[model samples]
Target: MAFGADELRVLRRALATVLHPMPLPDEDVQDCLRLAGAVDEAVGEAGRMRAFLLADLARYRGALPGSAAGYLELLQDALVGGYDPVPDDLAALRALRHRPVAAALLERCRTATERSVRSRLAGRAVPAPAPRGRLLALPGGRAADGEPERPKTPAAPPGPAVPPERPAPKPSEVFPPRRRPVPPVGRRVAG
Candidate 1:
């Protein structure tokens, strides 16, 4: 959202208040509230527009070569809005790369796709599932089915109560750094 001169002035004042907060005048408070509301509305509108653009891009993509022109246009706009190209988009761009525009877009899309993938990999790992609690036998050590418990064979004795200490892995080891794969020189990959 582009802020007007007046809005920018108000924004600067509001930010300054953060470091040296005093009772803001009623006029300044109103301006700040209005600016915040405008920002929220702009953000919501951008999200809705992005969703619509993506849906349109998908429809154009589904049409393939026939809709190549429209798809490329929509993709360029979407990229400006921070859209990440999917595999289908990359394939389509590669197919149309004979055109100068498509060739440039293919390179741009590849960079954006790689960046998106690396960011996902660098993010936190999936959390492990919670451990389940042990279930106890029914009262009197009988099975839940009202049957007598079977006699168990003797088992080996337990080891030491405390487990042996082991060195913890480094953070890098837990989530090894990933690098984007580079195709060998002079060998272009299709699709």
Candidate 2:
């Protein structure tokens, strides 16, 4: 995400050469080389992965039509098997639906509303404030007024000194024997 001095040099050179190639600067040439190297590396990687993803996409596309048809057929079969069609004129069937306490509940609810409204209007209103007398101190340890007390933070104890990290062994040093030269394939070689 961050560009260093070398990347900056490359960027300046790239802009100069591509847009205005004549009387090109050395900085521009270095920039062009850097960009070409980066592009080549990216292209090499993309070439390897592009074919793999494309093949997977082709396979999914091939199967999509058949899967869609199978789902449609399944829905059709379910509807045919489970449903028993009812007639549009169902007034006689609907008339049987009724709650036993429906009429009694309605009468009680209407009487309760009338009693609540009468009681609310008859009740007297109250004024809710005490007269100013003795001012009590706030729970924050302030004297009868609002002020924040600064809580002291404890100092951190010193940590132990960290030791320097050791360098990792090079690949050649780690596997020296494997890198040694072998005799020609035709020759009978000894280790």
Candidate 3:
């Protein structure tokens, strides 16, 4: 979403406040709040538009070869809006690949789909195996036939031990001791 000049100015001031914080004047605070609201509204509007575009694209896709031009246009717009082409989109584009535009879009969609798949795969973490409970072996434990059991292979040595993290210090502990502690309310100190 694009920000207007005034919005940009307010945003800059808000960011500056983060680096060098002090009490913001009421007017500046109101401007920041208004900017935030405008941003939120724009984001919501964009989401709605994207949803409408996808629905229109689906309708055009359902129409098949008859709606080729409209479908292609919508698909291109959807791509620009960060919509990843699904299997249906790929199949539709492939069917229309005879046309130069459709062929180009098909290749583009294929590359985007592959990149999306790779990113998803890379993001997935391999789950570690669950720890097994300790097996109890009584003094007389042996194979059912009384035959001696084979010895199991030795486990690999563990890596270096990491120290447990210390809890965060309280706000009072982190802040420097007060130069002059304020007297309690309704209990003024005598000079």
Full ranking by TM-score: 3, 1, 2
Better of 1 and 3 by TM-score: 3
Worst 10 residues of 3 by lDDT: 132-141
Model 2 per-residue lDDT tens digits across residues 102-178: 23333333454355556557783222112222212112122113444334344345443333463423323322222
TM-score of each: 0.56, 0.23, 0.60
**For residues 67-148, what per-residue lDDT tens digits would candidate 1 score against the true structure?**
8777888888777655678899999999999989999999999988777677669993322212222222112222333555
Clashes of each: 0, 1, 0
lDDT of 3 by residue, 1-191 (tens): 45789989987887787677555665776687687667657546555666777898899999999989878878887776557888999999999999999999999999988887786799942221122222222222233335665464444455333334544233233222324434667966799
Using alpha carbons, what is the TM-score of model 3? Answer: 0.60
Q: Candidate 2, clashing residue pairs?
A: 13-28
- Winner on lDDT between 1 and 3 is 3
